[model samples]
Target: MKQKLGNIFGIISIISAVLYAVFFSLSRKQFTETFLVYSLLFLCLYAFYKLSKHAFHVNYRFLSKKWSGRFFNSDVLVLVLAVGVICRLLLLTYTPNLSQDFFRFIWDGNQLLAGYNPYLYLPDEVMRSGASPIPNAAFLHANMGELSSGHYTNYPPLNQLVFAAAAFLGGKSIFATMLWMRIFIIIADVGIFFYGLKLLKLLGKSPYLILLYFLNPFVIIELTGNLHFDGMVSFLLLLSVYHLLKSQQIKTALFLAYGVLLKLLPLIVLPLLFKKLQWKRASLLCLAVGAIVLIGFLPFYSSDLIEKYSGSVALWFGDFEFNASVYYLIRAIGYEFTGYNVIETAGIVLPMITFLSVLLIALKRKNEIPEVLLSSIVFSFFVYLFLSTTVHPWYLTIPLLFSVFTRYRFMLVWSFVVFLSYYTYSNSQFTENLVLVGLEYTVVAAVFLWEVIFFDKNNLQKTKLNSL
Candidate 1:
């Protein structure tokens, strides 16, 4: 009877997931609809969780031998992955409902395809001067927003290559460009699933755990549905770590460098690796990483490239504030004291603190082992996000991916709650509900603190027992 009930719920969950994808794909493109769609999506996810917990418990022995074997079979894994892929494919038919960033991506790619340097001209400047070189320049400029159009692009070189590929294939069709980008992202996601499963096996954990990331609704919607390249970035980071654990230092360095070129966030993890290798090999690794990054930049290298890129990056620290936590509190305090917003001071101080926190984690932790190193990287990323002036929902994807290798599940919890930040998009005014933002961070921080304290206590007890 129990087994029957579980299977029933499992079927319902799958149906619900598919229905959610269909509704999401067909819904009107507005942020106001997000709450309803996301709520239903979460309900389906919860039902799936209950199905797995109650019906598929490892110790449940009510099933026949054949059925039980089937439950744990490799075929089931393939089926689950196939379902995820189908959901993404369904979403691919619709325009991105959540983000306009893809417009900038297509625009930049068009620039590259036309032999123009994207970094040399801001979208507004190109459009205003009537000197735009890219096809569909007006459409992209109108959609990418004033903030994006005013700034030189900050996408790294490797990411530009991907964009260029999309442009070359997409030509004048926005849908075609988006489709190509989504295809690339989906391919990268497939790589992550396989590599993540292997990494889990290496850690002596259940390979099924990879499904948590691979089948995650957030991963599906944000990466494949919205065409975010963070999915590719996550895969490269995981591949690098996997190679590192296998003692393939050169391959590890190369993958890490590629990941850094895709998204600069992986650079923070480099310091944590110092203690994992001898000084001589560590020096070589650093040199190799530097050479790879330099090579990536060679084609675009010019005096203005540095200025434009660095200036664009500095805006994140100096100007932007969104879905923040510790930085918000400090900013609030500054506002109360000074009678004005003080992002200028808070931004600078917060990032400096984050830098010192990551440096300390690198120096203080015993990261010679793979698990220890991964945990430190996760912690460092958490600190950086906690201190960041902006915490986009997709940014949590980084720490969430890293946490899969460690004992931490706070980042998993974060993946769900981060969706609340999208409420800011409910209207064009872009007004944020501080109350919702506060609620989101409060829950995430509570989970993080609980896990940190309890995980450390458990580790200390294990250390003591081992010593005896």
Candidate 2:
């Protein structure tokens, strides 16, 4: 029996190591390739299933030692860290296949080094006007895709700082710059692991739950494998939360300042901090975070910054629509009735609704404890995501991180199936298959209801919602 279990563990380790390569090398072009992507997703899901089950059933009996704490086994903790590091390091130099966002990342970095605020320059205009040129202007502009080339960059100032460093250090080599960016993201993931461990310990959940964030293949592919700086934002957000839990308001404000400057998701959860600290302190923290964000924007401060940034963000809510759930359903209704897209209207209303919903969550919940605090925050994000017009796969990582502290496993289900959205890129036109999108969300909704509603003390097995 022990031999069989040990062999299962060995097989899991080997399979995960091998698949990390396949995941890194995957190309997104669809025709004649759907089967491979689906197969890879299936195998990855299987790995998650087996590891989660093994972690629970054996309860780390195999990794535990006399000196280990009642909750976490340090040996298993090392195993989790090793897997995350090895998987990411293997993809360090590979070009991102599943996303072209990295091209824009490289372009932004090089643009910053060219004595221009990346936020202010439209890449397409640079090529057309022949302005102070970025080296390899044609190559970067061409590869960054028309949509990105035509738009003013929405990436915040702190992110641009990292890009400028990569550009400075990497010289003219795109791949070299990509290497530096990947290194930065890998370091951020390591921070996520460390702070995540401290959080799980503080919350009194299984420390192994960090695997849900670090070991998940989708996280590896989207954040590390595809060179998205959402990884960096997530790390800072985790650090901020850890400080908040420790009652270090000044430290929390500083970390959150950088996090919100990198991306807006951290700011979305800011009100939740009110649940942890007193009213006066929380107000001060909010002001501090805001002041820092304004200071961060000051260097790149342009008359166009606020207007251009808000317009760019407005595109996601009104102009852009992809892999959305409720928004799609609403859009279809509008098309049937008004014979036009309702995104302009829906975008205006949905965000208003999401704001009130999240505010209600933070105010109504007793969240001094990590479990409730994170649970309310994750659920608020669920409301936000379900109503969002654009739900990228990487967007799920924050909720997935928080859900670990609570009993919710819906984010786990969403992560596995979210890969289905990549099928949109299979054709050149970038059209999502509504059927596949339907299948994906139906599974998600079912699992969500099961975990949140149906599962209880006498019915833990009800999580056959396919989570563990």
User: lDDT of all the models against the reference?
Assistant: 0.82, 0.82
Worst 10 residues of 2 by lDDT: 30-39
lDDT by residue for model 1 (285-339), tens:
9889989999998899888999999999989988988899988888888888998
TM-score of each: 0.91, 0.91
CA-RMSD of model 2: 4.2
Candidate 2 residue-pair clash tally: 0
**What tens digits encode model 2's per-residue C-alpha lDDT throughout 247-341?**
88889999999999998888888878886896888999999999999999899888888899888878888888889999999999999999999
Judge candidate 1 against the unseen true structure and give its global Cα lDDT, from 0 to 1.
0.82
Let me know the TM-score candidate 1 reaches against the reference structure: 0.91
